[model samples]
Target chain A: MTADRPRTSLLGTTALLFEAPGETTLETQRRIWAVAHEAAGFPGVREAVPGMNNLMLVFVEPPRRPEEIEQRLLELWNVVAPLPIAGRCIDLPVAYGGEAGPHMADVIEHTGMSVDEIVERHSAPTYIVFALGSHPGYCYLGGMDARIATPRRKVPVLKIPRGAVSIGGSQTGVSASDGPSGWNTIGSTQIAFFDVNRSPPALLQPGDSIRFKVARVLR
Target chain B: MIKILSVGALATVQDLGRTGGLSLGVGTSGAMDPLALAAGNILLRNQENTAAVEVPVFPFKVRFERSTVFAVTGADCAGRLDEAPVLPWWAHRAEAGQVLSLSHPKQTTWRATRAYLCIADGVDVPAVLGSRSTQLRGSFGGYEGRPLRDGDELPTGRSNGRAVPGFGLVPPGLALPLEADGVPAVRVLPAAEYDCFTNSSQDALWSTGWKITAQSDRYGYRLSGRELNPLRPLELRSHGIVPGVIQVPHGGQPIIQMRDAQPSGGYPKIGTVIEADLWRLGQAPIGSNVRFIRCSWDEALGASADIRRWLANSRRLVELHCGERGGR
Candidate 1:
């Protein structure tokens, strides 16, 4: 066996749980993913899942004694350094306010601005994907215009329309599918965030960058 | 094959869990009480992760369309057939047309209770991923994407061996029951930034007890406790997370992730409930008091291993107490 492949035992299996580090969202996910990917390159590890701040490395048909595996994990985590995130950018088009987005007033009030001001401020800045959760292609993003930073709704909307563009505090996200939400809705985007038939399903991922083009009013 | 004479308040097929659909946002629907599921399987000498029936409350009943072997485990609720009291963990064989019924549990509230029935001949729900477990959110698995209702006909997998007897739950199952005493306290490992919280904040975390709100569901538990403020102006870039993640927002009350939890999160998490103690979360019904105690990473890892082993070996002994079913 390769020197990198240290064997240990536990739960009739061996696993390496890596404690990777990074304060920023993209950086942290990138580091965790790199270590997990690298672990898979080695033999014996059955599974390697990279999480927000950690990696769960598992063995294939592992030994029963866990202490053996625990010893190996400690050693592996010390050596594997995490990597930074690198990827391409994606832009989306969105329409602000009206029947499509009923909570536009709430977002405007929270931002202490007029509706036009809300649209301009929001569309002016770019956002980064922080994580993907709740729904497929549903991105919890960072880099919202801080001028519009506000707490979640006092009463969460029971059914946020699909494709609703909303902001929570300083973070922003696009709803892929209709669901409940506490995020203040400022607009709606026609962009499809998720499609079951797509090869990768979600249009965006944790490392991707995004920009928005505000929709103009129709005469 | 066994038949459904009655299916309590909530009953359906369950296995270890349903994965692969997480990225798609499907909840890994399975037996709330795994220990109970294992006992139901072991008593019938079935695989630990075999598909079994999970009965959440009263008004559920089943009848053996044909003679078969099966067992019931989890909760102290009495299983009856024509007023005959049956055991909980032991396997019991049934004659043709013999009806098996699970009565409502006497001990707890809205979410408390378990009644798993394992058949010697496995259930025949189509394998939707690698598991027979249900993804109730997507209406993907188990009986028509929901619990068993009246007039539902179940097919059976071919028996590994010809005509073996079955069993019912052992009396007084080991796990998943409330109104019991001195439950082993749940242990947690501080999150990546555990020390990020002020000493007062962290101390409050360990000392303060939060109530499990009724608003809780498969997605997450919205805990109610003291309002909290961060020591620093915090703005964390969103990141990935898992079940049992203790996410503390600007509001002091923390939201603990659960089975149907999303794969990632942006909220600042103070800690994670050790894998072993996650089951305790299921047992913690609404309005129950909960507290957290932090442990070292090493300790958390060690506990995970011990839990897996305990679950594996315990299935055998728990099955022993159940009544065996005799095949016709």
Candidate 2:
């Protein structure tokens, strides 16, 4: 059964989440970005943020008529065509395995692949930035090689350091800052994905492409 | 100016918090008890979003470098200014060279864990991305983007000279109290994945009194109660979430996201503590039990309106009190 209807849910009284139904795809996320851009102009809307395939519209004030806003969002989503954002493609040097990747063995164990095989597969795709979330400057990238995909850890790590590259289920992303995470870390990077001093702060935005370069393989 | 004589951990400069940064993955890091911050600002006749010192850990002591008006609101820490008792939720004038000390929060009349120290104007911190709130994760706002330390001297903004001391307003927590069977309660609305949870788990969520575990902090509150099991193994794509989003991890326990919670999460959401009631949860002491009152979208909005009405009414009353004293 195809869950085709775009689902709208209240996030407390502050914001509303609009989730595009069906499989998570580039097409759906593009439309989400478009809707976000449009809904941001709505009265009382503070910020329109796009997630993987969802959009959350935070209000300046708790919306008096939420149903009206929801209806407007649905109308916008139906009509607003997919917007292709022109974003920069940045190549990041990644140090895979060894101490940098304490959970590489776990990923190998789960995926039934060697460390070399996993690294090759992980770095093969030119991933697109699906959305930015989780933490400051962190980007949720799409197009990870499904063969190396491993489920998130049953128990999340209390504190993963900044620049930790990890895989969670079918998705892969890097830790922009030191924080708790539930993903399986397979590598580490030295790039600062976020700098508050820097304009726009986050290194990547939705539609940006990332190519991981294997700097070294510490077996 | 005030010199931090002695300060406990996690006390930081905060305003209302930075917005429009969620798309960049920046979470809103502000006072845990925002009502206290706003009320303190109201007491001082300062801007509603004026930066204040959020003192969670106590026995905080500061020496006033200049005579300035200040107010201590939220959890009454038994404030004392140079041997003179300074009432909580009241604005007072501090003489130059006077030391203001705050002790452990008294849980006698009101149960709260955080306090806001609002100066006459505000804490003079360089605003980053439209706010002075210390974003601990990003480390780029407030005073040096870190918690206050001993010997740290925070500059206060130039006083508008309109502040009149000796006036106080009723604390919003006392005015707008929400409880379930005498236990401090927060209203919650069902989230996107509410139906995904088992019927028993959904029932348990409303009926059970969840204890705030020690792991609870500004980032999120780890609640311990009846395990919130889902109907099936549920996995969600990472989605944007605000403070109060209740995510049920695979472990079955629910975690209520707080002010410093990340912009997104993938855990199955059972319900969200309404934004209006987040301040109540924010002030809830660790190890304390809290009940969840299931509410509708309309009810949640109503609660938010109620808080706004309370703030406006309090502000009006404070203005009148200050105006009368100034006129005299």
Off by over 4 Å in 2: none
lDDT by residue (B1-328, candidate 2, tens digit) is 8899999999999998889899999889988988889988888888889999999998999998999999999998999998999999998999899999999999997999898999996899899988999998888898998999999999988996878898888787788888999899999999988998889999999988999999988899998999888887776778889999998888988899999999888888888999888899999999999999999878887898898899999888987887778632
lDDT of 1 at A24: 32
Tens digits of lDDT, candidate 1, B134-163:
655444567665778777777777654422
Q: What DockQ does each prediction reach against the true complex? A: 0.20, 0.72
Q: What docking tier does model 1 reach?
A: incorrect
Q: Pick the candidate with the highest TM-score.
A: 2
Global lDDT of each candidate: 0.62, 0.89
> What value does the lDDT take at residue A36 in candidate 2?
90
lDDT of 2 at A144: 84
Q: State the weakest 10-residue window (summed lDDT) of model 1 chain B.
A: B171-180
Please, what are the lDDT tens digits per residue for candidate 1 over residues A1-219? 012332221211123334444333455555555655566655556555443354554545333444554565556555756665655687788877786567777776666787787778888866766445566567766566668876766444557877788886667778877765667777787777766456576677656778888875211
Q: What is the lDDT of residue B306 in candidate 1?
A: 64
The B-chain TM-score of model 2 reads 0.98
